[model samples]
Target: MNAPTVPVLQVHQLTKSVQLEDEVLHILESVELTINPSESVAIVGPSGSGKSTLLSLLAGLDQPSSGSIELMGKPFHDLSEDGRAAARAGTVGFVFQNFQLLPALTALENVMLPLELQGARDAEAKARHFMDEVGLGHRLNHQPGRLSGGEQQRVAIARAFATQPALLFADEPTGNLDSANSQKVEDLLFKLNAEFGTTLVLVTHDRELAKRCQRTLVLDNGTLVEAAHASTGA
Candidate 1:
């Protein structure tokens, strides 16, 4: 008998809501999902559909109000805040729609941030290499404000990859870029995935981007429904 494959991420009956003065706002309800190692999946939905919220839960950045979440085969709810942060540092990388680069840091410095957090030696060298891979070698010294939007995003991508995380979460990664720049960033993302065999969970409204993944999951009012299986040829 063969051993069973471990899921990289798992959520069971995940629910999140907030109590308001008037009524309760249910952001997510009874959401169940899983991602296996080396799989790429896209979560597609309109604004206010809880796509970002779901991503947060899966990444262990935010806790689900009710339900269990296991990341990298460990029960997430059982971990302390510091434990969760350490787990994320070891297992997850996140790219946000807003390109959350520090205004004070240069592209090189931004890429080095993750490695520094982990106390990795030779952080500067590794940061530069990743930045070069993202075609930002020339902009290494430029701060976020000095670089263009796409350039800033590439820096973010480089930073996300610097730690060589097992799973990568990207929320509307190309949402803020122009068409050409979007293509560049998209290509870089997929290239990294192919090279590293990284598990990907992406949230986006772009149909074209969603189709590129092996699976597409749709969220309607915080409930997940399978949209389509993996298909070749975009």
Candidate 2:
């Protein structure tokens, strides 16, 4: 008999809230989820539904107010800030809506940054390979300011996957792109995801984008539920 595979991410009663003037605003409440390795999942909802907040907690970028998060079988929620950073060093990757490329760096340098940080001696070679995979090899010498929105996003994608992380988190990846560019980025994102066997968890308001994932989740009023179709509002 084969051994059962462990889930890539697990959450239990996750919650987040903030203190306002004489009030406590709840952002998330008792969110429960499990994601297996190599699965593609989307989280969508209305504005102020706390989608991005949940993503941050799951990625261990921020601490939750309550509940535990297990990422890649480690107690992510229990770690200190620096410990969490250590955990994500090579195992987790992220692609954000605003291409977070260093403006001064060339496309290839942006892609190579993470690899170099991880002490990979062949950072440039790996960066070049993924840059070519995203059809951005020709623009490697160009800086982010010199590239179009689509090209910048493609560069971000290359940077994310260059680390070959076990999991990836994308926050409204196509939010800043036009329709045509959105479609192109979506294609490249899924293509690289499949090739790398990386588990994907994304937050998008685009219904079509959500539908492309194997599973869709809805976040509403600080709660989460499985969804057959994602709502395209806000």
Among the numbered candidates, top TM-score falls to 2
**Model 2 C-alpha lDDT per residue in residues 1-234, reported as the tens digit of each score:** 988888899999999999999999999999999999998899999999999999999998889999999988779998999999999988899999999999999999999999999999999999999999999889989999999999999999999999999999999999999999999999988887788899989999998999998889999999999987643411
The lDDT for every candidate, in the order shown, is 0.88, 0.93
Which regions of candidate 2 fall more than 4 Å away from where they truly are?
229-234
For model 1 the local lDDT of residue 6 reads: 91
TM-score against native, each model: 0.94, 0.97
- Give the per-residue lDDT digits (tens) of candidate 1, residues 91-210: 899898899999998889999998998999999999999999999899889999999989998999899989888999999999999999998888888889888878888999998988
Which one is best on lDDT?
A: 2
Give the per-residue Cα lDDT of candidate 1 at 28: 90
Error of 2 at 5 (Å): 1.1
